[model samples]
Target: MYADDTVLTVADKEIEIVGRNTHLLFEQTKQYCTANDLVLNENKTIQIIFSTRDHTTTQNITLPGLENKSETKYLGITIDSKLTWKPHIDTLCKKLSSSTYVVRRMMQKGGLDTAKIAYFAL
Candidate 1:
C-alpha cells in the first residue's frame, strides 16, 4: 500500500549503497507490518535499474520502515554528507594574508628585489 521511486544517471558505472543498522531497521518495519496484519509481497515490488552507455545492471532495494535514507555519489564523491567549507576557506585566507604581508613588506622597503619577487611568484 506504499511505494516510492527515484531515478538518476551517473557518468561512471560504479555505484555504492550504505545503510546504518539496516538489519535492525528491517526488523522494526517487519514487526510493524505484522502488527497491522499487512502482507509484504516481494513480487509486487518495483525494480530499480542502473544503466550506462556500455553496460546495464538491476537491483531490488527495499525501504526501511516506510522511510528510506540513501547517500548519492557522482563520479566517486559522496553528495549526501556534510561538506566542510570553513576549514578550507580559513586555510586559503591565511595563505593569502601571509603572502600579502610579505608583498607589503617588500614594497615598503623598496620595490621587491628580483629574487624575492621571483620566489613569491613561484
Candidate 2:
C-alpha cells in the first residue's frame, strides 16, 4: 500500500472537492495507523495541489498541522505543483559540473587521455 513515495489522484470539476477527498483520505490513514499502533509523521508529510489553472485557488486542503509545498523531492525526482523540470535539470547540471571538475583534476595530476575527459563530460 506504501512505497518510498506515492501519487494519488482524483478527478472533479470542483477543485475543492478533490482537496477535501485527499484530506479525508489522510484522516482515514491516520486512524488506520493509530489502530495498528503506528503514527503518521506529520513533520515529514506535505501536501501539493496541482492544477494548470490558478495556483492560488488550488490551496483548499488545509489540514490543521501539515504544511503544503510547491515543490518536493520524491524518491530523488523533483516534482513541483506546476510540473516544471527546471529544478531537476538544475540538480543534474550541478552534479555534472562537480564531476567534470574531478576529471579535470585527474587530468592535471597525470597525463590522462584527453579523450577520457571528453567522454566523462558527455
Candidate 3:
C-alpha cells in the first residue's frame, strides 16, 4: 500500500506530514484521518514526515480515490435526483403561485400587514 502525504488540521492548526512507507510507522492514523475529515487523494499522494512545532509525525495508509461515491444524509430530506427535475420544478411553482394568490387576496382586503408579511416571507 502506498502512503500519501498527511495533512493534520485541528482547530486553526495545520500540520503537513511527508515521508515514504509511513503506514508501518503510524498504525491508527487511518482512523484519525476519518475522524478529522481528512481526505486523501490516491492519484497524487506521497508519504513524508511533517515536522511541527511539537514533534515530527508520520501517516501511512493508502488513501482512497477522491471520487469515491458515498451516501448523503440530510435532516430527514432524502434527495436523489437522477436527472428528473420537471416534477420538482412544477411543485415549487405551484406552491409559489398559491402563496401569491393568498397574498393578493390579503392585499385586496386592505390587510396590508398580512400581505406585506406574506410577500416578504416568500
Candidate 4:
C-alpha cells in the first residue's frame, strides 16, 4: 500500500506564522502515518512559501524533514512562490514543441493526413 500526491496547504499573511503552523501540521501528519503503519517519504516532501513580494528580510523556512523549494508541481501544474504562470507556461510550451516535432516526423514518414491526425491526438 502507498500514499501518493498528498499535499498540505497552509496560508497566512505573515510568513513566520505560516512556517510554524506548517511544522505543526507536518508533525501531526508524521504521527498519523506512524499510527497507521505507513511510512511518510520525507525525501519527496517539499515546502514552498507563496508570497507576492520577495521575502529577502525573512529567514528561510526551516523544517527538519522537508527541503524548501522555490517551486513545486501539483496536479500537473508548476506553481512558483510568486504564483506567476511563467513556469507552467514554460512547461506547456516544451510539451507542445515535442508534440510538434512528432507531428513533423509523421508528416515526413506518411503525409499531411497522418500529421493532422497526430496533431489532433496530441
Candidate 5:
C-alpha cells in the first residue's frame, strides 16, 4: 500500500523559524516513510506560504527542497497565500458554468423536466 496526498503545514512569526521547522519536519517525515517502506515523491510535493506580503515576496519563500506554489488545491478547495476566497470562488464558478452548460444541453435535447432533473442532481 502507498500513502499519498499528505499535507504538512508549519507556521511561525518569523519566516526563518518556519523554514527551519518545516525542514526538520520534512526530514522526520522522510525517515518515517523509509521505515514504513514507503517512497516519498518530491516532484508532487509543494509548499505554500501564508502571508500578507505581496505575492512576489512570498514567491521565493520555500520549504528547503520543495517547490513553492502561489495557490494549491487541498481537500478540493483552492487556497492561496493571502487566504482569500477568490481562488476557490473562481474554481467554483468554472464548475458551475460547466454544470449550467450540461443543464442547458439537457433542456435542448430532452426538455424542461430533464433540465430540472439535471440541475437538481448537480
Candidate 6:
C-alpha cells in the first residue's frame, strides 16, 4: 500500500540460529504485509549482509525475490557489506573535481566572482 525502507535483522553468536531467525523474520514480515494489505516491492528491496565473511559464507542466506548486493546507496551515502568508505569517498572526489573544473573555467572567462567560486566549492 505504501513504500518505505524495511530492514529486518537477526543476529546471534551461532550462524545457524542467525539464518533461522532471519528466515523466520522474513516469513513474519510476509504475513504482516498480507494482513495489513501492504506489498513488498522486490525491485526496491535489497539484502545486504554486513560481515567480514567471504562470498561463499555470505551467499548462504538469501532473500527470495530481492537481489543481494555488496553495496547500496541510501540518502547519498554508499554503504557496502563490509562497511568500507572507499566508494563514498570516490564519489565525493569525482564530484568535487568536476565542480572545480567548472569553477576554474568560469574564473578564466571572468564569469564568476571569487565569492561565487567559494560558494561553488561549498
lDDT, each prediction: 0.44, 0.73, 0.47, 0.84, 0.83, 0.78
- For each candidate, give its TM-score against the true structure: 0.30, 0.75, 0.32, 0.84, 0.82, 0.77
- Put down candidate 5 lDDT per residue, 3-111, tens digits, no spaces: 5888778877877677678778888999999999988898888887788875453423465668888799988899997999999999999999999999999999999
**Residue pairs with clashing backbones, model 4:** none
The CA root-mean-square deviation of candidate 2, after full C-alpha superposition on the true structure, stands at 3.8
Q: What is the lDDT for 3 in model 2?
A: 27
TM-score: the better of candidates 3 and 5: 5
Give candidate 3's error at residue 13 in angstroms.
Answer: 44
Better of 2 and 5 by TM-score: 5
Q: Residues 9-107, candidate 4: write the lDDT tens digits.
A: 887887888778877988898888888888888888888877788787445356876788989899899999899999999999999999989999999
The top-ranked prediction according to TM-score is 4
Superposed on all Cα atoms, the candidates' RMSDs to the truth, in angstroms, are 15.3, 3.8, 15.2, 2.1, 2.5, 2.8
lDDT of 1 by residue, 1-122 (tens): 53222222222324333122333444565577678776655344322222323222212233333432233333434333234344456666877788777777777776668438844694
User: What is the alpha-carbon lDDT of model 6 when measured against the actual structure?
Assistant: 0.78
lDDT of 2 at 98: 80
The model with the greater TM-score, 4 or 6, is: 4
The TM-score measured for candidate 4 stands at 0.84
Lowest summed-lDDT stretch of 10 residues in model 5?
Answer: 54-63
Which pairs clash inside model 5?
A: none
**What is residue 92's positional error in candidate 4, in angstroms?**
0.6
Off by over 4 Å in 5: 55-61
Angstrom error of the Cα, residue 101, model 4: value is 1.8
Q: Number of clashing pairs, model 3? A: 8
